[model samples]
Target: MRSDSMGRQLLPKRIALPIFASDALSSVAYAPDEILLTLALAGSLAALNSVWVGVAVAAVLAVVVISYRQTVHAYPSGGGDYEVVSTNLGKTWGLVVASALLVDYILTVAVSVSSGAAYITTALPSLAGHEAIIAVTLIVILATLNLRGTREAGGAFAIPTYLYMGAIALMVVVGVIEWVTGNLGAAPTAHYDLVATGGHEEGLVGLAGAFLLMRAFSSGCAALTGVEAISNGVPMLRRPKSRNAATTLALLGTIAATMMLSVLVLARQTGVKIVENPASQLTLNGQPAPADLQIAPAISQIASAVFGAGSVFFFIITAVTGLILVLAANTAFNGFPTLASVLSRDAFLPRQMYRRGDRLSYSNGIIVLSAAAIVLVLGFNAQVSRLIQLYVVGVFISFTLSQLGMIRHWNRILRTRQSGEQRGRVLRSRAVNVIGFMMTGLVLIIVFITKFAHGAWITLVMILVVFLIQQGIHRHYETIRSQLRVDDWTAKRTLPTRVRALILVSNFSRPSMRAVAVARASQPSAIELVSVVADETEERRIRSEWEESGIPIRLTLLSSPYRNVIQVILQYVRTRRKRSPSEMLVIYMPQFLVRHWWENALHNQMALRLRRALLGVPGVVITVVPWKLGEDAEVEGHQLVNDPFKRPTTIPSPSSDTLVGPETVEE
Candidate 1:
């Protein structure tokens, strides 16, 4: 599509919801499981606390959504947390937010795809051991879809997201009705007993138990990872963007929190057991569970109990759950690129990231995010449980900082207006942000403290590395700007003392003759055709042709005993510049224009090498004289031919007394 059609890409709330909130909403698939698994580390009885953990996580999710609603309305330029922090605090704090979000977005993809792979294997047990391979394949597919464009991806993924939501809601309603009727049966694994860790045999006692509960709560907070995506993507929304984005955030919070809490409540009622290590921590009858036991996730168990295990509804819910989990990465796919484009605009990243592709999407950022996620998935073997340990740290960091920035944002507004309805609203918003700041700040600390040893340190280190690298890039750009800044146009426009053209001649071919003719046309102070003598036979042919052709320009040969073409030519150019510092030296070389990729392999790329080496030399300029090859040389937008070397009417006087000839001279 043409770039002008970007306006057509603005997403309405229906499509925008799935595109931006799928990650947070799809957390229902695994967030409850994580809470249950962490609680099961104590004992079967202690696992019952999952309901309370789910409630805590849901409450936090609600507050974060409310806080970001204000963010979208106040700063709808799509900078999200980075803009909030940078505007309120400073650029350094903004960099902190950007680095955290970047790392978190990558982890979102890795965790979501890995969790999706786990669900797939649950349905098809035959594909159990190759989760990493399946996950990598899924990522490649997702990347391809996103490369097509954002609105198209949203359209492709919307049905599955809605179906997953409908499936979870249906299961919850069915489970509740069965409970009311006293017909809900226990899960298939409900009969197995959980054995607590060695130190927690007594269960939920002492400070250790309190610490364990905090860890479980932190694990459940993974549900909040994608809440900021809507705020980051405000620019992609249709008109009334802030209002639509806030509405979407509200919808996300309600649906995601309700689904998560319902799943945990259902798991508790139906006695679905999941543990960190199912083999050693669970027992059937009197012996440890079978070594190869496959523990279905909490949602699957809940579905099986609510609807018979063999029921079609159970498989439908399972399939949709797996698909939604994979589609959840689409949220990051949208957020990461938009956020990267913002950073790129601010000069914190490469300028390439700021340009849109043919699809009007940030293609570079999408490719980069996919590559990073694939590395994480492969490195961790696509184990959601293990990968979850490294999750949420960066997100909570961003959440905490964003809330604090929002609080400051409201305070600034209140100071500007007093004694009116606007002041009252500003004060209320400030109160909300203050609460959000406190809640998220505490959760951030809990996540870091609970998961640091497990793998959260890796996240912190990555954020630090990204921050330093961006700082270095910004500083380098600043240095270049300062160096290139022109203080006086008069001094900058001073002319060179003389212009000397040097033609790079290889043989008496049409390409070489064209180079000499173009150089002579320029009417420089002097023109000298030079060649490097790499082989004796080639050198003799060139010397014979130059004398026979009687080219107006003189020929000079530079002997290369080491057969290093580029170095020999550069040495001579530098020596000439050292002798006459104010004269401008223009080096012209012949180059081929190929019609096909393979045609390029037929000739040497000496001109390319020479241009690269000459670029860094002071007061030197290089030009390429193209010689078109292959059929269809007269392609539109490309010059078809060059003027033939008409022996120049007259040769200009040489700048120096030195006469040029074919005799070899050592540099």
Candidate 2:
């Protein structure tokens, strides 16, 4: 209900790194595998080139990180790519990037959780085939953690991120020491021969080889998936938000590139051979490898080779890598809701997403993202390889649009600037943006060519659908705004000059009597008690009771042959409005306020229908005169009063010289 706590400051550099960079940093755990997996299509010798591919990917990642650093510094209000594209290009381009980023953030959660589940299943064999269940459970847990608020979720991720970094650094150091001492050993799978599938194994070696290399490069681009996340999170950074976010982005790029390159190098040096189906594709001494021979992850293999099998350090590295991959989705958690909030404010999404929960986080957005990711995980059976195909495309789509946007952003600034430091900065940033636009656009093209058939098209379709939905939402809000506009006619319209009150009576009970009393106090020009004669016996008893009370208001009966109370009253109100559209008809319906929840079932649903019908008739008002039962009155004394009818009466009556006491309305 409160405006989101803007008093919350940005993240400092130390905290910002883990908060914004965890996704990219954690990709080192999987990027090596992806590179090797893609090249393995061409056979083991082709995968031997994976180290070079990793380096190329690392270079691209460095360029992107640097480009985004400039982006963050230039537009630190934290619209991220959407802001960049919208400002530089146009609103439509900005919307496209926003939609792409939204889709990517969702895939990030699904892929990260599924990958984490795979690692867990590898660690615990009994959990096999339950991957979807485990993945969804992890998502739910993460959603709950995020719902608790951003700071707590960030704190939860901090340790795992640092632990992952420490473990990878230790592995790298140990691997280097072993290599220098000539003691580095081959991985357990190194002795197995890898049988390549697909036409990639054909040694045509010319343009075909170049295409294969492009494919490998495209696969390795997975490392760059989370690079832009830091820029999206600039608002979460501390004072000097731009500077802190840039530093965090730099640290993220350096560490991630180092870890990924080292893993690839170590895998190559150790003669590691990873296959799609290890049990069938791997051969030992010209025979198929054992079916139960678990193929450890690329990082796990490197860890074991450096630290020796079954060592504590090996287990530590394995556990930490899995933990960090699971927490990697936390980056999406932070980015998705913030971006959703921005979109919602722009009317491109449901405004509910902008409402924060008790913990001051966008709880609705978190739940929505988690639900979407779970659907993808279940639909794809939590297979990381297939999900990986659907990745990179969205990230690169955003990347291309954002860079182009930044170029435009800088040009606008340049036009107004003179030969000063600001001008130099703008020119330098423009150069970075230009380079980024070309590089990202080319990679996007490669990704589409290499992966579109492999399920990347699914992501594109999803982005289009999201874009259309956003456009629809914007149109819907626009339509509603047009409908609700207040013009001179609306402002100058006068309330009805007179009130004609009617008390709906049945059997002349205490409720009906109270309705009449409240209606008379309003000083209506004409007051009457109306009852429906659905049955002769009931109508006779009501008339007898009314005559016995001898009330001042006249009692009248309307015969209903079809026994329809709502229809009869609605027809009468319509006739009255037709006769005197300028006069207000106040229908006082006697109702009982009950104490227990189930007691609501005891009442007729006719009141709801009557209220809806009356709203459409001009100059007609429906007031519910609630007669509290004894138990309801007692319960009301104990509970907070939120019911509109039961609120303390504020309007003064002409007969009362003094104000009514609050206690008078308590019953």
RMSD of each: 2.4, 6.0
Report the C-alpha lDDT of model 2 over 1-667, residue by residue, as the tens digit.
Answer: 2444654634567766787787888788888888887777677778888988887888788789899888887788778999888887888999999999999999999988888898888778899889889999999999999898777777788888998999999899989999989999889788988776656566326666677778778878888887888777787777778888888888989998999999999999888777777766778888988876777789988888999878999888888888888888988998999899989999999999977888888898999999999999999999998998998999999999888888888888888847798798788878987888898899999999888898999999999999999999999999999978877796558666767887877667666766766776676777667777776686667767766766645666777868887778777778778887877788998777667779889888666677787778776788897777775454333322323223235533322311222110000
Measured by lDDT, the strongest candidate is 1
- Residue 230 lDDT, candidate 2, scale 0-100: 78
Which portions of model 1 miss their true places by more than 4 Å?
Answer: 534-541, 593-596, 630-645, 648-663
TM-score of model 2 relative to the true fold? Answer: 0.88
lDDT of 1 at 336: 97
Which ranges in model 2 have alpha carbons more than 4 Å from their true place?
A: 1-9, 203-211, 290-293, 420-422, 489-493, 500-515, 525-580, 585-591, 598-622, 631-667
lDDT of 1 by residue, 261-364 (tens): 99999998998998767788998887898877778999999999999897999999999999999999999999999999999998899889999999999999
CA displacement after TM-score superposition, residue 464 of candidate 1 (Å)? 1.4
* Residue pairs with backbone atoms closer than 3 Å in model 2 (clashes): 10-237, 10-238, 11-236, 11-237, 11-238
